[model samples]
Target: MSDTPRATRPGKTPKHGTGGRGAAPERDHLRADCANCFALCCAALPFAASADFPVTKPAGTACGNLREDFRCGIHTRLRADGWRGCTVFDCFGAGQQVSQVTFGGVDWRAAPESRQRMFDVFPVMRTLHELLWYLTEALAQPAARSVHPAVRRTLARTEELTRADAATLEAADPGALRAATGELLLQVSELVRAAQVPGRRKNHRGADLMGAKLAGTDLRGANLRGAYLIAADLQRADLRFADLIGADLRDADLRGADLTGALFLTQAQVNAAKGDKTTRIPAGLTRPAHW
Candidate 1:
């Protein structure tokens, strides 16, 4: 038997509603159940053969690796196989929305006719869910508290769109969803970037800049604690006054970066950086003795 690690999810709680401020702190929002979905994105989206994704699949064709049970056949060996991209990617709660609400919990095996319906819902639901992930993360920022009220409202609005019925989800104008999400993401970016403006950048607390390209940038007074920065490109960047507590920095490029005043960066993160001895670290972060 393959010693593959499968996610054993027992009592996993998905967000039933967006937690407004004053609500109880939410438990973790786990990876969505793809089996519950119609496997819509997998069937509806197209992938080109590239370094990031080695295989090219056309729209409407399920990934060859996807089993009839709506699971990835190569789940355990994603990297060993050509599916490393899928393994690293997270759909937040999109897979669940597309599976349950959009399709009313119908699967291809149950109703072959629903296959086309699943395709119709995939693109729309994916876009909304992606925005939800960003907006949800943005709401967690303390330094951005001034904008928290607006951020929370926007998150709930976007979350509502994902839960719309099929005819509503399908007939809904894609332009509207794109425009709203684009505006919100742009606002969040502007708020973060404003602090990086020439000698005038404001601070961001616990913001989400995961997988963002911030090469050779200045990020002084930024509060980035508990952010998901996996594989983010921060080469030669300045990150002074940044809080990095509990942030995931795996495979993130921090070479030639200056992290003076950044808080809560662990020794493990320092070791993960492709930095030279000359690289500057914040007082909060100490170089591993091994380094």
Candidate 2:
């Protein structure tokens, strides 16, 4: 996956309402459940031939390696065959949501008329699910208690959007919603970082630190949000409590790096980076197999 920055400037907070019936689903619901999905990621997303992919594939077209049963033909050998991007790409459960929940288990093959619409809605749902993941994490931070109420409300609102019908989802504009959530997350980051780092903390938000040698550095509570750290040497770096949201860590050396309590770090980001068993990651994320 490319290390494109996803951060946006803070915007006005949006209004929230009481969420839909029943409590919000657990974190597991926000993760990609391929068993319950129709392989939307394989068909809906387009890719160009590069270091990450061996061949070019267009959007709304099933990958050449996709099997009739919706599984990758070479799942076990994706990376070895030069499909490294597929291993790190994540849909955050949006595939199953669009396939089973929104479309009621209807596969695009069964109803070709809905193919284009389904492909379009997939990305929108993915964005909403990604926001939900961050919002859920924000609510778990005790130091951000002051904003927990807002976080809960926003989570509910975003969840409600996920349940909307196909047409509604296709036309949904999550740009404003993303900005609002970004602002709230910034507040939470400040609260947690202030409490974790006693004195002056490094502020490197949006810095271009690509290929920089930062081994064994003290970066506790640092705001490295949206920084480009591609191919940088971060071995044994002290990144505890660092705000890593939107940081591009592709090919960055993470051996022995302490990412415990790192804020907004996603599995895709970790999977894209180089790490080892000694790298300490936050709870709930699996260590990359290549590490």
Candidate 3:
């Protein structure tokens, strides 16, 4: 929801639309190829003392737990060690792209002068990749066929920007691009949401629903796009056919919630939220191992 793509573990790749025509190719580049990356997320980004991070780290500074090999020293113990943020952070594959492609495989450690450039370009690359993720999703929406041509062109433009040089990437304004693509996605969402019948309409786009009690609510086919559901009591809520694109679900209780057919529910959101084994999700997305 921060516009920064969320991170997922190696084995937990995002499962896109089922049998979507002209579905984008496998997003291997959008994934965190840590082996090929120089730990851009751990080094270029900053973190604060919170439930997700153990200590405060300044931007462009390497995290204390970062290893010489560009892996976290306590990677396996991140959650237990009060670094829950690391577990939920996904770069959408910008780390490896900037490391291997933009910088020609030169690492920040070896070239100190390039470190700042690498850090600056990393976020730009990430934003572009995030746009790619959305555009690909738009193309997969058969219901939004009217906008597929524009979506395809936009996707191609974003892909070209991702392949730009470091200078171009650093100078690129991705917010404007995201704004333009967001308009198209909005149209797509309208087309998709129009088909579903809501038991009770819940138009809480970007609304603050944190800590709100909504247990056993009939939210079938509700549009909860960009809703802030942090720490909300959603126990046993009927969220079937709900559109949850960009919803902040951190710490939202999902025990026994039925999310079957919920649209645009990312793995990152699921990983950040609270749930139990009884919670039902759509097919293709496996429940987090930690949950």
- Number of the top TM-score candidate: 2
What lDDT does each candidate get? 0.60, 0.85, 0.78
Off by over 4 Å in 2: 1-25
TM-score between model 3 and native: 0.88
Clashes of each: 4, 0, 6
Worst 10 residues of 2 by lDDT: 3-12
Give lDDT tens digits, candidate 3, residues 229-284.
99999999999878888899999999999998777676678888899999998764
Better of 1 and 2 by lDDT: 2
Q: What is the lDDT of residue 159 in candidate 1?
A: 67
Write model 1 residue lDDT over 95-197, tens digit each, in one string: 5666665665666557788777677777777666655655655554454566767777777776677778777778877678767665564555455445543
Clashing pairs in model 3, backbone N/Cα/C closer than 3 A = 6-90, 7-89, 7-90, 30-92, 30-93, 52-85
Pairs clashing within candidate 1: 37-99, 195-201, 195-202, 204-223
What lDDT does model 1 reach? Answer: 0.60
For 136-254, candidate 2 gives per-residue lDDT tens digits of 88877888989888888888789899989999998888788788889999999999999989789999999999999999999999999999999999999999999999999999999
